[model samples]
Target: MSLPSPSPFPPPSPSAAFRPPRLLALAGPTAAGKTDASLALAREFDAEIVSVDSALVYRGMDIGTAKPTAQQLAAVPHHLVDIRDPAQPYSAAEFVADATIRVAQIQARGRLALLVGGTMLYFKALFDGLDEMPAADPDVRARLEREAADRGWPALHAELAAVDPRTAARLAPHDSQRIQRALEVYRSAGRPLSEFQQGRPGRGLRPAALLSLEPGNRGWLHERIARRFDAMLQAGFLDEVRALRARGDLHPGLPSMRCVGYRQAWEALDAGWTPAMLRERGIAATRQLAKRQLTWLRSMERRTVACDGPDPVGDLLQAAREVLR
Candidate 1:
């Protein structure tokens, strides 16, 4: 992709000098044109792209993550995209730490840092910072996993209700992972995760601007999602999933495996689902993810720009330049 021309706008004033390094965050739902827009903006600003996506963190999980291709990667440097194995876990705290280092490096090089992704939680972690939650206790998690396997998530839900009713009330009965996490935290820390989050001060990095691209037409967005899934299939998403599965380290319920397309692919493999069924499920899951992204964007009021037209990249760069000015 060709780089867009530099913005004509002047930089921000000196009074804003004490601000943390200016970060351009491009966020939107799946297929809302974040990748293309970030690429263009990075070129225009001489910035490096730091991915805030959870799925893209895992190695050997390419096509479904919609990771940039070798050609595209060569166009501009991208950070934290494929830094971990499928079996290893990466968390929001880790993201913030790594991203902080990357941002500093980008600034030292006299370039800006542009974070781009659809992962709402990742973006939230960067901006609001994570609570100083305790590290996961493997023994506790293993015990919970065993309980879930034996008696199922309802039993876990009941346990959570007894200890942390607030979290239990908020989670669905079938939301095993979150329920388990809540219970684990309550047991280990003697406090609910929500309470911990509330106690934390504003420790997150505030971006210079937050640009969100939301299509007014859901139908159009869904169509784009379907097309993108089809392209992923054509681009070997299934093979990538299969390779990750063969690693014998990834479980379907792990955070990495639970990413939209990955979960669907795992389910298809487990149920002996046909190729057509897998593709259909993947597309549906991606659409749902997009809806969630839209909801997140809508709830964030400040520094948000809604793009409803065809040329979101053009509008996004113009908006970023405006923010810089």
Candidate 2:
């Protein structure tokens, strides 16, 4: 995959003293109120938005993604949303390339680039430079596919364990896609995928501040996740999935269909699941997504804002102004 070049202009360092911020990342779990907080920051700083979401890239996935409404989107210029059809894949590498351009353009216009979303991998790839790895080898992939057909993905996962234990440990035994890629890298390059992942974290796009919104109490977040999923159901999330399904081109394996709510809804439609069952499954999947996102948030350097509190956006504004002078 192609990479974006190093930025010509240096970004502001988070540790530097009071001045205008060139960029800010307002990241949090799903339904943590990042939208309002990011908008507040953007308007205050005369910034434009660059969404850091995986799902928001798709054209027909608005409600399930909790994408900004017409009014919210019209209020400020946004980039990177509705740029891809649901059938096409949008990789983290692509996000880095796209976001790099958007940030440069925003700054060129004397506007801050306010990144907002829970898609941690995109954020990581953009801020920390991506490491170079071997490209996909069709022959190698075909051989691996034949091997998986004969022995199953778990067995292949065991082979990956022998070569790249770190990558294997994180992957489930049946995670065929990631397992295939890791093994393909090992066989093609004779180097473990973990080696590439660790070799370079990438050049930092030093923001004026990196604000992480998380609740001190995990339960509070869980409650919010539950309520939000219920609201989605009430707001015609199932009918949205039905519309996608009616298209007949999408499938469960596609990344777009595999998103939290859409995944459950697709299975429900296929199996004729009761609404209760669909709701339960969707809520559970969303909670797991939030948990994984929180784990990623903790690894990066950022100021923590308690999003569960009554005045999360207000708290975020205070924290932002402190560094974004």
Best by lDDT: 2
Candidate 1 per-residue lDDT over residues 80-191, each given as its tens digit: 9889988888877798899989988888887888988887767777776777888888889998999999999998898888887876665667666678778888889998
User: Candidate 1: which stretches are off by over 4 Å?
Assistant: 1-21, 150-176, 198-202
lDDT digits (tens) for residues 1-325 of candidate 2? 0121233335546675445768878889988888888888888888899999999999989889999998999998989999999998787778888998999999999888998899987787777766777877879988998999999989999999999998887666766667888998999999998776652443757666668888777899888888888988899999999999899899876778878799889889889999999989888878877877888787766667777777888788887777566
Cα shift from native, residue 77, model 2 (Å): 1.4
Q: Provide the RMSD of all predictions against the true structure, rounded to 1 decimal.
A: 5.0, 5.7
Give candidate 2 misplaced runs (Cα > 4 Å).
1-19, 135-162, 168-190, 199-202
The collision pairs in model 2 are: 129-202, 129-203
- Name the 10 consecutive residues with the lowest summed lDDT in model 2: 1-10
